[model samples]
Target chain A: MSANEEAARHREVRNAWALSAPALILLLVAAIGPLFIMLVYSFLTPGQYGNVEWKFSWDAWIGTLYSRDIFDGTLKLADAHLTIFWRSVKLSLLTTIITFIVGFPTAWFIATRSPRSRALWLFLITIPFWTNLLIRTFAINEIIRNEGLINSVLMWMGVIDQPINMIYTDTAVFVGMTYVYLPLMVLPLFASIDRFDMRLLEAGYDLYASRWQVLRRVIVPIVRPGIVAGSILVFIPALGAYVTPRILGGGKNMMIGNFIELQFGQGRNWPLGAALSVLLLIVVTIALMFYVRASTKGTNNG
Target chain B: MTTDVAVEARNAVKAFGQGETAVRALDDVSIQIRKAEFFTLLGPSGCGKTTLLRLIAGFETPTSGQILLDGKDITNDPPNKRPVNTVFQSYALFPHLSVAQNIAFGLEMLGRPRAEITKTVERMLALVKLEAMAGRKTSQLSGGQQQRVALARALAPQPKVLLLDEPLSALDYKLRKEMQLELKRLQTETGITFIFVTHDQEEALTMSDRIAVMSAGHIQQIGGPREIYTRPVNRFVADFIGETNFLSGEAGEGRVTLASGDVVQVEGAEGRKGKVTVVIRPEQVRLAEAGAAETIPATVESLVYFGTDTHCHLRLKDGTEMVARLQSPASGEAGLQQGQSVGLRFAPGAARVLED
Candidate 1:
């Protein structure tokens, strides 16, 4: 090739690399580097001098597998971590299911409205998300506590003999988490439902399909993508949450977030803490993979 | 009760809003669609054509009317309980279902056995010539394919009457022409009463056995295509169906005299003598030599050359403008030029006298 042709090709390659360098480096630092650090820490052991050592060994993994007495006696191996993990999973699952049950009807109502009314409803849904997450959790706490609004109202109505034990329980955690993530579940589903064409429902009715049949066969399938997207939004955050559960669970009935906190805080066993973090990441990763596959199949078939 | 009328709307009065702002969409409109015939409601936009279609489909209830299908009064019935199906303009196919499942949806709603639903869906897919795409997603299909899938889905239920609301306007020009013939063929093969609503005059004229031309919540005329085109009942019908040269004149004893000093003989001229519009089709006007008996001297104003015929815009000395169609092959008018003088004539019954 001529010198000019060679120089043009080199310029094209240089420009392409230049344009992609920022994004590539950001990905490496924000995502890839932390994951590499976590993987290394997972294989490391606590040093004799009260710090993590760089020497690689499978001792942490083996200890987790075989040290039944120390791990189980302390209730962190199978019972404690497993219970916390399952609790987190259940809480997230319930949040997702409840959000869908509520969000679908809410989105349908909003979608059928006039443009001005729909805009107003959208503004209302977003107003709660504007405040800080801790503030919202605390607000929930104040409302359900001993001297809170429900107790005050019950006492005034003379229904209860004394203030009910309302705060610091699993129910409290569920309420706070659901409140925080309800909008997250609603917005995406609303987007999908809002774009739904009403003519299809009309067509369904004309074809002798009952209202229930139309909802089952047409509406649900068409809005599944939005449902999947919203479910993921609610499920992932509820799974890894520390603030809402910490405030609402009141430290006694702790979830995985508190377990992770105690291990790294007062417990001071960084290797076990790293292992638990790694386990949480693995669970989330598997779930995200399944979600991606299901969403892809839905779009492909549709 | 034993009559064979597939669908009938009796004095249907559908109004929107209330008080002064109310629009009577269908004002005492009545129509009977015979069994297994292709009936078309042809009108311009905002003429209540779609409203009428919705009323018959049971999507909307009329203010005061009785809708009967198969001799059963279905005036207050919901759409799901009616023995009718509609193909929407947008098709509205279930985006998440395959073509086979989309076609089988109604049968599934009816609680048909899975095997029966499958067999019927497959047959419908073949009928619409979309069996190969039965497994494909609706988005993967073309516009015409979606239209056929919609047709198959609606037809699989075998309703008493089928409604189509401008189903072909979404297609391209060539595909729409092809689908028009396919739709007619489907109607013949299935023997289903089709009530189609469209604003396209050509589509209505070509496909419908009988057409109701509606305007402003009123049906201007209802007849066969030829009769509606030739014998329009009023000036609105005449002007809406096709182009007509409206020569305002005074009617007298068996003759009408134009303001431009031209006179023409017409039938039924003695009944109304004040004023009338002489409706003449472009092709009916004959170009002849300057000395014919009924000929009037005219000057060619403009010449438009169509592929098959040439349209000559003429202006008489009395300031009446008229158009005549001449068969010309060449690009330039053969032996005709703007500003040239000629004589225009027509047969005795060429023009239809109409009330404005």
Candidate 2:
């Protein structure tokens, strides 16, 4: 702590802040600004023609899980919206679990390859994203449709009498979502597993542990941070996913994002849509907080 | 001829890659590890000693030849199927498991009863003197503590053979010295065949029952510490194990002739009549005052002082360079200054004349 060194450290801190201030200001304007506007709009009333009336009201908050019954001047729980929300939550959880089950080994394969082949495997994992995700979602049709590649091949081989109805089903939606978001799960897992010290696995083997025990007791526990990170990456995006469900789900099994879109589009209720958006954000934030707490607890115990 | 050999490698060969880029990591190596012996494979880096150790541990299969454990062929056995364990150089304890859990891992893998596992883990914790730290995370341990954990975890399973890969190399000098004795004590008590690998000559000398000296993926010699140091079969083993002064000369029956036409009498010349190199350790070349009988004439160059001794560097009449360690400052000719004439004496059978 010489005086000159202290002055230099202060200068470094000042320079760092100076370099970072522009990005901070940009985030405040672009990201936080919209959220603030949305929050205020959720408290405002909607005018006759889908415009914000700019007056304060709690009616929009009340309308999030309720719809007005014009005959009785009373509120009733919006069963359709609740069902959509619940379905979105369930599908998101399922997607996270499936992605993890598949991603863990995929990440391990990438992480354990020779340095020359590791880059190639990672590149192959991300190849699905070469085309736009929307196009890839549509490509599923060529495989799952009645006259698509799968049905044609199956009938030509005489394995099936008719094409199975896969489109607009929950299975199709899950398949589409899993394929689209798999890289999201794998990248974080790879980052963590790659940094793991492989000697621990060797030690496990030397101690007479089977390959399964090594993975269960050694590899999985060490890479838990990656699992948590990958789960978060898949779960949050899958919860708000509207594109895959709209196209693959045939608008039949609507996610929360589709519900929100309906509120702003055909439903023409701007205030209710804003309020629903706020509710989704609140739910995601609470879930994230719970995850963060649990992960911290895990680290503390470890 | 009939000692109970625990581990044996017969003409093992290991090669990596193919075509023009191929490399032989182990070249036609064979060894016998006796039961309950502290055997060390000593060599410099890239000398294939560690590879040989891994082969015995069942981590690597030989490209050719057979490995036997207690007279049973185990070359085809996977690592987990073999009754051998290793204390890795990195001491790869699971970062998530506590010290006791790490020691208990092998027993659990064997499907041992719960009471037996607990008792064995408690004994291991006591053996490593880590009982007070049983619940502590391995990540929280010091290097020495973690090393003990690795040793305890490997030894807990009571394997027939234990492999240690440069286990003490990562510790500080004081800790290494202490653990060397500790390891030897543990081996004596357990009566397990210990195969230790290291490049340090002193470590091999201090700890091993016998040392296998290797260089460039080839074994040069295998013998007890005294035998290996006193009678190295080749130049590589002589140069690697300790400091030596080489004299180029021609060997006759009990005599040798220097390049400068000076004749020196020596025993064990192998009765040959070609060029040879006589290797002598520094301490074995005794330095005395000039005009001593049966001593070679030499001029003192410098007396380099070590704490307990002085190395008297000198040149003989035939211009052969030599160094002799004097154990006492008051020893003969030790007080001689630079350029003083002194007579150098070789102890009986101290100098070994090797065929070049």
Candidate 3:
């Protein structure tokens, strides 16, 4: 390489690092800093009145997996923690599936719109992101409650004798999550599907493929990276969800988010909360790994 | 309505948008393609050739027309139900599927048995000479390889007719030439009607059994390649296909009086008088001694040697320009030089008379 070209390349590398330094420093302070603290404190004993003690402790990790008969050293399943984890997983999985079912068609409609109107449709998709999540969940609360718009209309139409108990149920939680996270799914789905060549659809039809076969065999496989990316985006947040389940699932329903909050607030077990937070972070990391693998697999195949 | 008429369009009209924004893409166009023949729609870009092909493929519905396949009205039928397939210009092979799987897709769409699909896919792979790359993804193949895979995939179902929409326009010149001959061979071997669309006049002339030359959403002429080249019906056909020297004059009794008041005899001008455009092929105009029977007086303007032949640019006494393509040996022996006056002779019927 020439000296001039080498010097110019070094300048580019320096420029990249200079641009990245601010974000790197902010992440170290805001995210990794707290995470390191949590990891360290998970191994320390809980002091009285919600503080960490310097003394060593194994009880927090032990409490995550099992309950103890200290005398016999025999282990039993800790259904208390396990139930919340399983509930979180189920809720997130259901939310991801339902969001995809609704988001795919909406994304397709937006992607196929005329270029002039595409911006308007995409703007509508992002309107929800402009509002506060807490407000959106509570706004949904009014509609699903007794004497709300749906039940009032249904009863007025003679479909029901009285207002149904739609609030304070798992159905409300499912609905809330799907509503809030739909835009997340739609954005990525739009990016992938929008870049797709519409001529391929015509080619599929010309080659005698049925509509369903085209969607299944051609469209879905091509947009799969977007689906996986959106799954991680929606599922991870919904798994650790706290506000919607509390507001719409109505406090009677508890998720992993509420459990971790209770450990630090009412239960006052700092070490256990830190350990549970670490575990949740681990689950999220695995989800991120899956996203990386899926994206890289796309490039390797190309 | 005959059985030999593979595909026919009657007065097809396609208009996009409405009111002020409306553009008529195909204006009352009609043509018939014969069965088992290599037919081509030849035109420049935006001449509505692709739109016509799309109408036949069921991608677009004509505003007013009847499209028939083997005497069956299929204007409203969906593409999936039609007895036709296409090799797309982009070669839209499924990126996620292997080349073999791409070839098998149409067969599977037809609900063919798995064993039959496998056998047909194998045969098609070998036919396109992509057998060694059968298991590779479509994206892994080169542009030429992918084009062949697309051809194999579209041809696997053995449709009654195949629509190729400029399928060779994307490749480099070398690959395009190779694929052009390859596609011709494929069409001949399969004995299926192939309607190819292209903007290339050379490709159309080289590969088509019959060429439909379109312009401004209307078909200007349709005939065998040789006939279209040799005997164009209008000035547009003459100017578009190849080089021609247009001589405008007053015609009468198989002759024209040049503007310089020199009487010249020409073919295809019988019983016609008044102003007309006479298109003469460069190769047909012969040069001899300064004065000869059935010849006109002209001066050599310039000479451009292209190895095997030399194009002698000439100007007649009336200030009309013409070009004559002369072979190297004969033109050299004639001792023709720039600024030299000579007699230009043409055989009977070598010139065509057309309305300006």
Q: For model 2 chain A, where is the 10-residue window of minimal lDDT?
A: A293-302
Relative to the real complex, the DockQ score for model 2 comes to: 0.55
Ranking by lDDT: 3, 2, 1
Ranking by TM-score: 1, 3, 2
Per-residue lDDT over B125-212 for candidate 3, one digit per residue giving the tens place of the 0 to 100 score: 8889998999999888899999999999989999999999999989999999999999999999889899999989999999999999
| DockQ for every prediction shown | 0.60, 0.55, 0.52
| Displacement of the residue B192 alpha carbon in candidate 1, Å | 0.9
Q: Candidate 3: where are CA atoms >4 Å away?
A: A1-29, A65-76, A147-162, A287-302, B1-3, B19-22, B289-293, B329-338
TM-score of chain A of each: 0.86, 0.92, 0.90
Docking class of 1: medium
Candidate 1 overall Cα lDDT vs. reference?
0.85
Error of 3 at A218 (Å): 0.8
Docking class of 2: medium
Clashes of each: 0, 0, 0
Q: Per-residue error at B82 for model 2, in Å?
A: 2.4
Can you tell me which runs of candidate 2 are displaced by over 4 Å?
A: A1-20, A40-46, A52-79, A124-131, A139-164, A295-302, B1-3, B19-22, B270-273, B328-333
Measure candidate 3: CA RMSD: 3.6
Candidate 3 CAPRI grade: medium
